[model samples]
Target: MNALPRRRPNPLSCLAGSLLLTAMVSSAAQAAPSQQLIDAAKQEGMLTTIALPHSWCGYGEVIAGFEKKYGIKVNELNPNAGSGDELQAIKANKGNTGPQAPDVIDVGLSFGPVAKQDGLLQPYKVSTWDSIPDDAKDAEGYWYGDYYGVLAMGVNRDIYPESPQSFADLNASEYTNGVALAGDPRTGNSVMMTVYAAGIANGGKAGADALNAGIAYFKQLKDKGILVPVNGTAQNIAQGTTPIYFDWDYNLLAMRDKLDGNPPIDVVVPSDAVVAGVYVQGISAYAPHPNAAKLWMEYLYSDEGQLGWLKGYCHPIRFNDMVERDVVPQALLDRLPPAENYRKAIFPTLKAQSEAKTAVADNWAREMGVQ
Candidate 1:
């Protein structure tokens, strides 16, 4: 037995054993790299973000916290840009490793799949991925919803003493030329969601067919001279130029605070329908600082990060989860609309959203005579 040394289990077997060991080690090395990622990101020392307005969803605090926590500098580009602009920036700066490139984006929910399809987004699931709702995230992690807002009617009480409580109330003769939208539904996500909410209020559902009802509703507003052509803004509301504006609850809430009793602003999620729209976060496919992007995602989805959004009046995507875990502060929770108000809140399926968007784009001008 000692003579052959048991043939050493054969030379070919030894080679196979060595290959298996190498593969195992490689896999282990690849799988356990959280600390490695942190180190690499620290070395990079920089990140680039696009279209993140400081006021939107509390991004200012988030960016500041991230920089302070990691000592990484974040270069924000086009803070006032729209979701469409964000996608264009990614395409325009593709393959560029300079400061101009965007490392991450937070876009409207409809734009998430579009970015993924264009190969502009990379898959990255944060540590809190499990807590996120299935409907709010891509299965493969290409993108995930960070926060959502309900479409609400914002009324300047100085202009309309009796605030509109329902979408139907906006159609009253008294509200003629009073209703305004944040932007054209053809181009703005908020406006699009407003139209969708109208559809839901009018006995229509949330699919392709339902979109026609939305268009019809807007068309009627336009015909009755109730729909103002001007884009709605907090300034416009404060000035009484567009007293009754259709906008996200968060925006209206912030506006109410900014107005601060000079002209009381009232926000009401239409009693007839409560519809919520989501904003998604994604890492750029060509991110120059990939690890830093990952770290940012982790921060955005963490309890601390979700709370930041809450501080800004936007509903975090994991709000329900946070409530269940009792992680949400009682004071903050109290500020939110009573839970019963959200009982009827409806979210359109991704397919329905795509179809509805197409419907809006195709017929908005024809139906309402405004593009």
Candidate 2:
């Protein structure tokens, strides 16, 4: 009789309970990432790698900030590989590489085309795309420049107390046997770009023919025995081994911090003939973490990201809004000589660059005897 009294089972109630349990398990499985996971990898903390040839221009700060914000550590490798070497490394490790291909690359403007042609770049239309100057990036979205450096003279004050003020001054007899260069046209893209820049500083495309003047300028220095084929190096500038060197303004500003006493170095943005050359960044086509890479690209071109260059004495290619909002500090701005100095900086079209390169090499060999 007691057993029969307990047999008041509700079939509907048991079915409802079964359905509720199933629903609860499904919801648990589909639950969104917790704050912790989001903190660890906003999109995905997978991993990001960059090939940065330039020394850390306070980039460490940028990395630290990004890591803290996204909960992902950024791995930056500044291999000594120049433009050629960097490309080769990527090509060599294309398939059998690590988790990510060189996710990001920073090279001279000339390398952008080289990389693009090799099919090494991934295209992404960044949020800041419109802000970038038309001439500074690929309209199709292959690469974008985050910072730029002007072709200027790096003068060692200890050696050349009276630093040359213009490119014209550099060619004077006094600078003979004193001006240093990394390489002639043989393997130096910077040298080549500088020649092109000189042409622009002299007069944009109309100035294209004027690049010959750069070779002539070098010829004078070589004749005076002042042309010391010393590539840009601290040893050359610090020991007064070579009093003058031609390079992007960033290097000169950087040397000020790299060498002890920096030897009272002076960087001049030749008001008359300075050309601005850009350092470009691109995402690898085979990026393992394409999503993360895209996000990183966006961050780099953002107001916060580009302004980080100020810490390294590099100028932001975009983010003029930050300057307008005073988001960047004055001290950092001071490190940059002046944007107007680059107003006349020449940027050759891709087609013109091809012609210009050959022209520069031929002229340098005959005039500067670089060969």
Candidate whose TM-score is highest: 1
Positional deviation of residue 137's Cα in model 2 after best superposition, in angstroms: 2.5
Listed in order, each prediction's TM-score against the native is 0.86, 0.75
| Candidate topping lDDT | 1
Candidate 2 deviant stretches above 4 angstroms: 1-60, 71-78, 99-101, 183-188, 198-213, 258-262, 338-340, 360-371
Positional deviation of residue 167's Cα in model 1 after best superposition, in angstroms: 1.2
What RMSD, rounded to one decimal, does every model reach?
A: 13.2, 18.6
Determine the C-alpha RMSD for candidate 2 after optimal superposition of all C-alphas. Answer: 18.6
Question: Could you give candidate 1's per-residue lDDT for residues 199-310 as a string of tens digits?
Answer: 8788786666667888898889888999888888888988988988988888788778778887998988899877777889999999999999998888787778888899
**Alpha-carbon lDDT of model 1:** 0.78
Model 2, span 162-205: residue lDDT tens:
88887666666677667877555434556776666555444545
